[model samples]
Target chain A: MNWVWLHKWGSPKWFYALSGRYLPWLTITSVVLLTVGIVWGLFFAPPDYQQGNSFRIIYIHVPAAILAQSIYVMLAVAGAVGLIWKIKLADIALRQAAPIGVWMTVIALMTGSIWGKPTWGAYWVWDARLTSMLILLFLYLGVIALGQAITNRDNSARACAVLSLVGVVNIPIIKYSVEWWNTLHQSASFSFTQKPAMPTQMWFPLLLTVIGFYCYFGAMLFMRMRLEVLQRENGSQWSTTEIDRLIGEHK
Target chain B: MLFRQPSELVNPLAFFTLVGSLFPLALGTQPDFLRASAPGLLWVSALLAVLLSLEGLFRSDFDDGSLEQWIVSPNSLAILSLAKVSANWICTGLSLVVLAPVLALMLGLPGYCLPALMLSLLLGTPILSLIGAIGAALTVGLRRGGVLLALLILPLYVPVLILGCGAVEASLQGLPITAHILWLACLTVLAITLTPFAIGASLSISVTE
Candidate 1:
């Protein structure tokens, strides 16, 4: 049992230390990758034979879309772990993930709409993929709302976790929506399971951006989680010293 | 103070469930757009039913002091919240599933699509319950929470509505309904697995506040 406690998954103190160390690397890597990917994608990749310059939006759109789903799953996993183990850190992670996930969803929607105007000849369609993505945005909003609505930190964390877990359904809907129904949105051009839909140059920078965005996500999540941990643990002995030190440093 | 007598609500749900199913029938042969919009209309009304039923989910327990007992019970607050949400769904969402075919007919949904419609509703309504529970749990003790609940819940309802309507529409168009059902069923499974945990957490939080 002591050994198991050594590996305790829910320990806030351990997570705080670990995330503090990890934040710098995530920030640096995300910045480098995003810069390289964006530049290479915008300038180097060949324009689409069909959509011309407008196809460039895929660089932003795909990564954001993928991140949106990934973060939701992360939120669900954190929520589940929090519930099952009564882990305080997991709840913090769950809350930290929501706003980032929501931002990713918003970016995806905006880029999709921007991409849509040129490619699909309209800004909006009742298309399954578009609609499902919109719903994905809503799910994120619900989780965020639930988080804010709750007053108690721990209870809010738990509620938010549940919202994340339940809302996981929207992830698959967003993923397969383009395929399940005949719609205005095109099928995925990039996949590991099947041949890449676009040429190498296009997929390469996009992949880089995806990796960069992930690092960025990690950095942001850790930063937020750190702040949440500090807020929630304020009156605790460890945080009291930390908070005093932070305050002194700020002065 | 706000609640009707316990006896009052005992059969109100059943009575309202019947009235709920009768609403579309009363609107017969009127607006062409509404008739054409059958799938959306029934879906909206069904959503409204879920919303209406949600008001009583935590309210009654809250009003009667049972909620305080549940909070302090040996059972975890999360578990109690899950039980309440599932019970609420059984009373409300299950009723929608049972009433779907009749309502489908009234909404002028095609005869052939009735089976598919009912099946989708069976799978989908639970999700509505689960998702709606998040909103209900959040606003459980808030005053005049209907609009807030609507704002919080309506957006979440879109995917279920889309897939539900999609399945029936597919059946009407004679396309393969399997894929649509598969998607909605997938959604249901996801909701079943995830929502209770969420609503439970939300319920606890609301109570604490």
Candidate 2:
């Protein structure tokens, strides 16, 4: 029932220091978890019966794809918070997440394509999931583009928030439409979700990687949010004091 | 005042025809290829034309200080923005619909598919303008918002493009097009009902700044 933390979250100084404390733990956890998961999936997990060892690419591809969607949802939620509560930190978080989301989308698409060539016999196919992922990438880039294009900082944040909110609404429609279009075309590419029942060996490492990736996202988001807070709040009392502390430490 | 103008409609319709004509030159001169590609080609061209016209949707108003007035006016900005978008639909979107037959002819699109093609545009073009106005409003204040406008709006336009072209293609195959047309209508309704609020928000930001 305590809502003080919601308003507490609006304070840049509180968020900055809190996330600074969180950063190291998040970094170490993500790094360790990622290394263990990747190594386990690569070496310990059994090879797929159909895909051979090539199926291992799913370790990276699936995690990136998962992060890709999660980041967009995060954007929409952050944008809504910023829009409704006028939380400056929420706007900063929303903006910082765009490029990270785009990179996740790109990684997902690249790994998907690389995996596709060996398994699906083509470099690209307008399959539903991959096509929707591509659209998600465009949605990310659109937010980034809108942010950079506008001159006024506050205006840009609000504008990007609006666009991303609209994008979030359309994301499902685009996904479903792409899915329907793929079926109508009867695209030659096979659907990846027809996934066979894995004997736990495959999906267990996947579960680890997914967790690791989420931790990585948390780490990256806060780091970016911290830097954004510093840059945007440069002349303010807290940022200036923080700057002085940094400079003093450099000596 | 814009309603009185003829040239406003001329350029986009010209661009629509030009884009439609260029496909045959690039793809092949064969009527068969042109006909087959017509549905997709026309839909894409209309989408582009709507995008091109969107650059000016709020630009002139923003530059002239009228957008700011709309934001501060007693009337609902969303309703006013919807009026502007409807005007935009008539100028850019409907122009493409009227020119659909001529562009289809250039693409060697069959007469039998014309009703489906034009009807699809009738249902789809307003969605283009309505949705595109969001991008136009978002980017209106920027020096080079045109390309960014395309980047932001085109992804949203994908469903419209697919549904509109699919309707025509379905008709070409002697399949029922009710589903595609229904989807297009749904999108147009969604766009009409919702995009004005977004455009209002975006315009308020741009004009206030």
Candidate 3:
């Protein structure tokens, strides 16, 4: 099968139309999956058998942690594509992803700290995983700050992309931190491909939450991409009509 | 790749490394428990070793328009960058590898653990050079960015330091250090495969402005 459509992906107009078609479905899917995850995690799934009620935070914490990392990779890939192809939409994609990544990192840290309180007996420690996550947050913030600092659009995108790619080094550090150090945090007990250490009642909801978070990330990215397209394309005659039509429909 | 080869005899990294390693050696420490911290001392010294060598990687080229010339050259930048980092690994990283036994011995590293220390440094130093390339590439053109460069890279260096030290510590305890070696190898392979593209990309971006 000729997968030529993937190469045509650099076009903003095409991506905008495609994402518009997919956004509503993603929104619905995210809401449904998230609702199921929280309900199942909180009520149906057995508590940690060890940590009791506080164990429920895993539903939020795990998903946020996963999203925080996955989003950065996506951002870097988008940034790479922008750099390679000089695609304006790829730059837009990169820009849209930064705030989402930073926020996801924030949520991961917050929920992880909250989970730590009951499980680890403290809100924070200089644990490898926790500290690296903090550093990842700063890396995201650095990209956003650098992006904003550069007034030139192309320079800003390139700079942010470079920063994100360099920051990709932290992913490994985060992954192996526990193994490398005597940290309070335990090693990863679950793997997506392997049978989770937890029962299906717990694991299934986590899977759902992960899927939901992915959808939510997509929806947020699409919304931001659309806004960016409108702003960037405002000066063009074709975009003027398209944006006006969009605005008129909203009115 | 061919274009990045400099005809000049200048090599600033050599002098930098020679002077840097002596800084800690000069500090007079009492015959106390602090001196007993062999793993910690070696790591601190190694960290300084990596940092000192990193200064001239990108800065010197950046100063003379050679960086911009390399960025726009017909050669594949990734390959060129890989060559440069390989040179760095050879020069400074090998220096660390060869210096490890001597330094470890001075830091009171047990004779039995020297093999593990050397093995860890052998596997770990290239990864440091590779990761350090990204930081050097990022701040290559910036003025007085050494501090920012350290801040950006040191946190990411945590895993390497942890694993590098852990391997030696485990060997000192007579525990199985195989897993640590495997992980360090994995990190090295990952860095070797990925960092060239990253450094090349970052170098171009940094020089563009």
Best by TM-score: 2
Chain B TM-score by candidate, in order shown: 0.82, 0.97, 0.83
In angstroms, the error of model 1 at B78 is: 10
TM-score-sorted candidate list, best first: 2, 1, 3
Complex DockQ per candidate: 0.36, 0.90, 0.31
Model 2 lDDT tens row, A90-201: 8899999889899999998999899889888998987888888888999999899888888788888899899889999999999888888884223322223655356677
User: Candidate 3, which segments miss by more than 4 Å at Cα?
Assistant: A1-9, A39-48, A83-86, A125-152, A155-174, A177-208, A242-251, B1-36, B71-119, B174-194
lDDT of 3 at B5: 50
TM-score evaluated only on chain B, model 2: 0.97
- Where in model 2 is the C-alpha error above 4 Å? A183-196
Give interface RMSD, every candidate, in order: 3.1, 0.7, 2.5
Candidate 1 lDDT over residue span A97-154, tens digit each:
8888889999998999888898888888878677777777777877777677666677
Q: Tell me the lDDT of candidate 2.
A: 0.87
Pairs of residues clashing in candidate 3: none
DockQ of 2: 0.90
Query: In model 1 chain A, which range of ten residues has the least summed lDDT?
Result: A173-182
